[model samples]
Target: PGHQGTSLKVTDSPRKRGYYVNSPTYGGFDIMTATVGGVWDSFLGEGRRFWITATSDSHRNVEDGGEDLWPGQYAKTYVWAAPDQADIMDGLRHGRIFVTTGDLISELDMDIAGANVGDTAQVKAGQVVTLKVRLRDPAGPNANSDQPELKRVDVIMGDITGKADVKADSNPTTRVIKRFTAADWTRDGEVITFTYSFKAERDGYIRLRGTSTDELEPQADALGENPWPDLWFYSNPIFIRAR
Candidate 1:
């Protein structure tokens, strides 16, 4: 909530779908949910093209007991774009991006049929949508000088229920549809691959979350906890449009 019973007009015109900026530093702030409900609130129920981003917002040096890390030391927003500035800007505008914390994975490319992240794939309602993913775990020490292992990856799906009460903020239909482990994926050196298929019962979106721990879902951070040991990575969704 933006205070006093107001919500972002994402279900309105494209011009009204405001951007969302989040940082791990304040994960428990939004309505005190400490989860992606706000993101799902805007994305699901309408298939709206809202955008989300993670930032450092670093201003002071940590050595002085400031609350921040050096840019990319613990968080990064990876854009699937050329090295050029304009292309990267375009990628951000179009949602071709993924985010990671503590360097859990270096790459994540997911596809459904011929559509990639931020792209829409057309399909029949009963069609089976094959998901192919390619990702890499650096397997090296992260900013914290600790080597972390990727424990699992989860697939989350949510239906496009078509608009919502402007005051609405939750999608009850959203859930984790699949979970992949070392046995569930193929490995080649530092890269990992996964394949899955699900029926296109309706229009929806799918996204990925990979972590270094066995926690079914990301747990809220605790004080004095080593951030690098509990790493996680998340990819922007791939929308599905079905007849």
Candidate 2:
């Protein structure tokens, strides 16, 4: 992906979607780190219902002189669906998904105003809504055979400012509005839960990003960076509709 990778010359059709932030692209190239978050911010700035998923990008591996992982051995996209063709397809199309790397988490559920990820919550103009997140962080070792811990979780929120400039590559309105830690949450067995409230004064969206490292933002993937110690999990956005 090119720097920011946003431009107005692209397709405007509803069916059109830009490139995705796959694991290989982000983990293999130091230059692509900025592009990863740029795409996320740019889409939400447009108020479009865009989504992202993790991929193993299976082609080769570090052992094979290529940066890839066995499919689902490292990065995985989890969809909320029944074990059926129709429901599975439907869940994907509607963005009922979360992604994790290195098995940092086995379960994640986030909701606001009873609307889960990829769903829209209708509210009064300035309704205060509570966001609740429950996640299961198993103590079992990951693919690397080392158990990585979840040290922090970030709450990223962005505005729905309507259509965007085709060339816009950044959403200045989006940011890690909150960073939660053990002191901020409660743990029950292997499950940890976090809750926070915000004012929904306008159309916007909120999603999540968590990591085992202390980097406030994901550092650019460095050469030979141990992937296991630096794990991440991401959830699709939950839209807010203020009436």
* lDDT: worst 10-residue window of model 1: 1-10
How well does candidate 1 score on lDDT at residue 64? 44
Task: Go through the candidates in order and give the C-alpha RMSD of each one to the true structure.
Answer: 9.2, 8.7
lDDT of each: 0.70, 0.72
Q: Against the true structure, what is each candidate's TM-score?
A: 0.84, 0.83
Deviation from native of the Cα of residue 58 in model 2, angstroms? 1.7
lDDT for 147 in candidate 2 is: 84
Clashing residue pairs in candidate 2 are: 7-166, 8-166
| CA error at residue 191 for candidate 1, angstroms | 0.5
Candidate 2 least-lDDT 10 residues? 1-10
lDDT of 2 by residue, 28-98 (tens): 22222223347667787697767777755555554554445577777778898999999988888888998
| lDDT (tens digit, per residue) of candidate 1 on 91-110 | 99888988777778889999
CA shift at 147, candidate 2, in angstroms? 1.0
